[model samples]
Target chain A: MRRRTPAESPSKLSDVARLAGVSLSTVSNVLNHPTRVAASTRTRVEAAISELGFTPNRNARALVVGTTDSIGLVVFDLKNSLFVDIARGAQRRARGRGYSLQVGSSDSDVEQQAEHLRFFDAAQVSGLILAPMHDAPESVDRLRSHGRPVVIVNHDPAEANVCRVLVDNEQAGFLAVRHLIECGARRLGIVAGRRDLQPVELRVEGAHRAARESAVPVEVVEYPVDGLEPEYGDRMGSRLAALDRDERPDAVLAVTDMLAMTIISRLTAQGIRVPDDIRVMGCDHNTAAWGGAIPLSSVSLRGEALGEHAVDLLLDEIDDPAGHVHETITIGPSLHIRESTVGRPTATPPA
Target chain B: MRRRTPAESPSKLSDVARLAGVSLSTVSNVLNHPTRVAASTRTRVEAAISELGFTPNRNARALVVGTTDSIGLVVFDLKNSLFVDIARGAQRRARGRGYSLQVGSSDSDVEQQAEHLRFFDAAQVSGLILAPMHDAPESVDRLRSHGRPVVIVNHDPAEANVCRVLVDNEQAGFLAVRHLIECGARRLGIVAGRRDLQPVELRVEGAHRAARESAVPVEVVEYPVDGLEPEYGDRMGSRLAALDRDERPDAVLAVTDMLAMTIISRLTAQGIRVPDDIRVMGCDHNTAAWGGAIPLSSVSLRGEALGEHAVDLLLDEIDDPAGHVHETITIGPSLHIRESTVGRPTATPPA
Candidate 1:
């Protein structure tokens, strides 16, 4: 048998007022700002709320506050630590403001992303934070028509009239290649995943830019991986190892930390020495990359900051919908040079 | 200033029926089982549903169908690769069933876990999947009383009147130690984190059981870490490296793969040759263990399978409310012997 509440409808503010023998505004005051109500009266109102199981109806509440107390976040891949860090930052900020969060992963599928957006729209979340893969502009328009605020992450909003939180991927790429060049690496291998991805292309472009600007002549080779996974990296690692020592690139930069770690493992197993033979670098500065078999050198994309600012941007839009001016916030990337690039020994005891 | 629907109330079933010129049952039939209604009738009802923006009230619909179309999942730590794999599997299964998943991380805090649960209950998710850190029984009771079904992951239900999806932690522990013993290790050290945690205790119990079963007298030593993280592991690694060669154990197993990898890295940096000097093993078989500098030997806890089965258990409860009996599903663990134990060279080209 299904459970049912005795009340005809979900408990209401009026019902709470009636049960507390107080005016409607008194009950509203107690709920909206308990400090305004006398302590004894607030206790009575809270008891009434509990007795009636009165959940402040979000739809009705939204009409009063101009938005619901819930935020929705959609990511390209939830399994990635980069997105996990973003979600963590968003959660911290949302909790501080007494809001709940709903999360979804599109699994890199545009249709799935669209479906998640539709769900959020119907659920009536106050604001949305999306680390978009595709259809972001169209989806943003659809969501905005429902009178909800949307913020995009990772992607450069470009000319779109939307808020975006981004990291300078091109600068991160330039830093990686430039550092390798400074380390006397003239021949470089770029382990790229999915050319269609904007971040991947931008990183490659930045690497080429840095190479062209270098005083020494440099040759950059591209090694394409079919997917953003370790399996693809493993396959590429084997192929790279087969190249004669003279033919192989002296340094490598993987698109993501996962690729960097897997390729390094395979390369090490093939008797190739890291830094001594070929320095390896990765993007995203993932948590896994730090304590793995090799501490990977990476461009720290500041995932947590991106997530926090995205929520801040969305909330700003939600607060001033009519006069809201869309703004794009681009965060800079920092490089963490660890064992893979610098041949630094682990466990250096504190000074 | 707030957005409001034009209708006095969100369009009800009656509105959908009247607009389609059909009875309430016919509208319900069209929505729930379209095959029961004629194609023309179904089209008319769907059009009315779209026009009125009638989102079948989930609270009202649950009285008839016993459940909603949303599920909630909470993990103790989102940073752990173990929980990420679990979430990925749960999301995939939830999507296949046409349900949306909401995810939260408790950050190993009991109060945070309770808050997430209360939020999930208020949001009215039909079912919840939790990888709980503390207060399992109390939290389960609170949610159950609110007519929500919950499935616990990692923790054994242990005769509780609730559904649970667990991996054999005791067996996983036994396998780790037994494998080391089989590989000719006589003295062993176990890096344990928080003896109060049931899983940790259970794993330790299993390792002791394996040691007792060994024919040769084996010395088992316990090294306590304040937390189950890489920092603690690094601390423990330094201490072990400083021990006299004659006093140090020939093999070691950490409670988790995170600890194992860090310890291995630290020991390697301290000039300790793994396997040749002291073999290292870990539990939970995290993805990071695979591509780390050492390629750690670990007991694969099958986190994804546990997550997938937990969803199945929750859905079973939702589908057959009265007939559903709580079940404890225990998945077995497997050992992955890698370079940390075997120390084999990588990348031999396949013949």
Candidate 2:
């Protein structure tokens, strides 16, 4: 775990050149193209490099070799703790292999994503691990044409030529809805910010499939939101509270932990007993799912695991760029049951 | 919002040399030192540059100049959402100024922090925004000596020459304990990972100061943990719960929101009623504060604003390195009261 890089005062090529009594380019040639340098000059430069503990700047070395010991990652947003978790995992793995991670956030825009891609490409990074924004199939192609190894995270390009690590969104939806059904909730609701998203559509499909298999007919309703932020949870809570007693579903599932927890908070503030009057669940068991005012039952996306796997795949591609075969790794999500969807009575206050 | 970088096919200097019908070194000389190139050759190279839209690679340019259009940030940990919030704010400010943010987490290790510093130094970042690990005074000195502007975030270096953005930890601690005392809880317990750490010591000192001001006798018990993680919260929760009923503190304050929420979850699982049997609070008002099962009362560190201010300071230094005066910017913390410290009775279920 202890990685000691070279001394604080890095020995430069100029210092090596001074010690070897040669031009700076002679020292550079000794490192980059030793055969081009005179044997005596190369020997003198090598002795000086050892004496001074000189390490060439990776970027300068990369300029000659076309690659650096750095991995580039572009996520949708750093503010989202889920992406942070992924980045943390990626950093750990990248460091274990002696490579540093260079990160950029696209902020969920295709143009920004393309800009980031261009930067990484121009930087000549050894490899790229991207969580694409807006399904940029063309951008991926552009990245490939630049000749860097690529591993797309979370999204499935559904193409054989790209490597990706993905979660089974459809299975996650089925487990969540089926759990509610088994808990005696015949009416269920799903809240999604973007109904058109592929993951959202898959989750909805999974929920519908679960409803179809149930012995008792389950009525599934979908609630749409203008955005995917926590405030929408408050909006949904207010709208649901305003509904007729029988019109509101007894159980609700939110696409993310942030939205689910806020909805629970808003509903609890209105004096509704969670898992009693209405059960609530969420996906992406982020910090909110396990830590909220009412612990939310949720489907886990295993973001850290996704990130680690993506790095492994990207490194494999980097090692043998020409020999690399694109492959997809799909990880299944798990359900975490908590007080929000299960009845847990409060203890009597200490007398 | 749509900031476009130059074309993906970046024009190279070789292309300019080919167009100008000049040697590569002639074009290089024309760009780096126009006096070295013949007047006719320089004119041809300038015309070729205009026609080819060739801009020198940033890394190559950074070698001549001591900086690049990239801002480097080093944080303690990314999993701690507070840092993520700070990064989000820094990214926003840096983006507005046409600088790209390059982030690295030190994982709370001084060595890792130094490694990141070296990477940024070798990469020749325009400026550095650092949340130092273990309060290394020399690290900041080393960074500044390298000619890049350094803005220390979170921890105040106490040295006037070192720019910093800090949170008033002592004030935050006093607010949390005073709030508990105002709620009629005299006996208090504070769970901290390390009492020796500056932030932790300040918070504990704040609690003591608040106790001195309160009308009632406040017997504050300090509980130390191995680390500031959720597992430590569980450890503290079980130990507190094991204490004799009459000896237990009336209220508890955890060092972080994550720890506070976990303790609440553990205590609730053991049938203890929060804010009824014992009021609970936390600090750093991170995501766990709002999303936890009990909706913890916490002191907000305003991480985003801290990050924004850090970037502003760094950018100012980057813009006018010699003219810049290092000053500390302290932002006061605010308290957020929620259900963890305030009881809310649920409404009766519909008949």
For DockQ, the strongest prediction is: 2
lDDT of 2 by residue, B1-351 (tens): 122254344455556766898754455457545885688889899999888766543444333443337788898888777887788888776665556777788887776677677767776778889887557778777877888888888886667777788889999999999999999887899888866567877888888888888888888888888888789998888888888878989999888887888888778777777878789999887774455556678898888778777776676567556655566777789988877888654443443
**Predicted complexes: DockQ each:** 0.15, 0.24
Please tell me what DockQ candidate 1 reaches.
0.15
Encode model 1's per-residue lDDT on A1-351: one tens digit a residue: 123343334555556777898765466457544786899999999899888777653344434554337788888887677788888887776654546576778777776677677667766778799998754787888888999889889987655788788889999899999999998999999999887887888888888888999999999999988987889878887888889999999999998888888888888788777778888999877765543455688898878778877776676567557645566767788887777888755443323
Clashing pairs in 1: A293-B292, A293-B293
lDDT of 1 by residue, B210-322 (tens): 99999988999999899986799899889999999999999998988888888888888888878688999988777645445656888877777777777767766775567
What TM-score does chain B alone reach in each candidate, compared with the true chain B? 0.77, 0.77
How many residue pairs clash in model 1? 2
Interface RMSD of each: 5.1, 4.1
Runs off by more than 4 Å, candidate 1: A1-68, A229-231, A242-246, A261-278, A286-295, A322-324, A338-351, B1-68, B265-276, B287-293, B344-351
